[model samples]
Target: MLRRLALATLATTAAGLGPLPPLPLLAPAGPDTLTVTIAESGHPDADGTFELSCGDKAGGNHPARDKACERLERLAGAAEDPFRPVPEGQPCTQVYGGPAVAQVTGTWRGRSVDARFSRADGCEIARWENLEPVLPLVRG
Candidate 1:
């Protein structure tokens, strides 16, 4: 059954039919400290920037924890939109956040899309999403 489904998907793609369900575009909102932008194409991609202020104290107890807290606090102040891409006949999950990066994943119209973001400087960052195994499906 799985093989048949795959074959069907391939055939549809070859015929230039539309891909599976499309991912929705979500906007970011909240405190002005954080900003998020999402771009839709054959694959969906997003970019986010976080602005934060380091404490006045030069150094103190729990420096590591303090830094982590600062990072988390910046993330908390930022806004995130729930937008992702969907590939045809494929299911996927999107995971965001790492030591200092954010990521997104999913199947979009029979193609796999991944996006990543990182802090570019002290107050700004950017990210881009890429689609793989390009299919012949038109964006709706």
Candidate 2:
């Protein structure tokens, strides 16, 4: 009787071990997101400069031309220098005054993505549409 009880207890313990609850599969990393960095130039009256690193289809937009231009002008004024003129031989005309709006098209991971920017301090301030994907995490 004792041997049987010991055997039964062992069996119960073994049964309790059952296969480790399906190891909750680890989630895979999703697509990358947009990243922006702003730095203040030491020079007085220098508008802060920003660098934007775009990722995947996560960034794109179609902001109104006038609005974009306005933003660009503000950025330039803050940066203490107007937009740099396009190189002498460049196909695109030099942008000056107000905002600089141009369709921003790019390729990432073999996919085509588009975005718009208002040139500020020689950098692009991403519009709402382009910034939407990254807003949630950044907000809090």
Give the TM-score of each candidate: 0.18, 0.18
94 Cα displacement, candidate 2 (Å): 46
State the TM-score for model 2: 0.18
The segments of candidate 2 whose C-alpha lies over 4 angstroms from its true place after superposition are 1-14, 18-25, 41-140
Residues 1-140 of candidate 2 have per-residue lDDT tens digits of 76876676677769995333333453233432222221232322222222223323222232222343344335434752222333355453243223333333333222344543343422233232233222111110
Candidate 1 TM-score, true structure as reference: 0.18
Give the Cα lDDT of each candidate: 0.33, 0.33
* Candidate 2 residue pairs that clash: 47-78, 69-99
RMSD of each: 20.1, 18.6
Model 1 misplaced stretches (Cα beyond 4 Å): 1-99, 122-124, 128-140
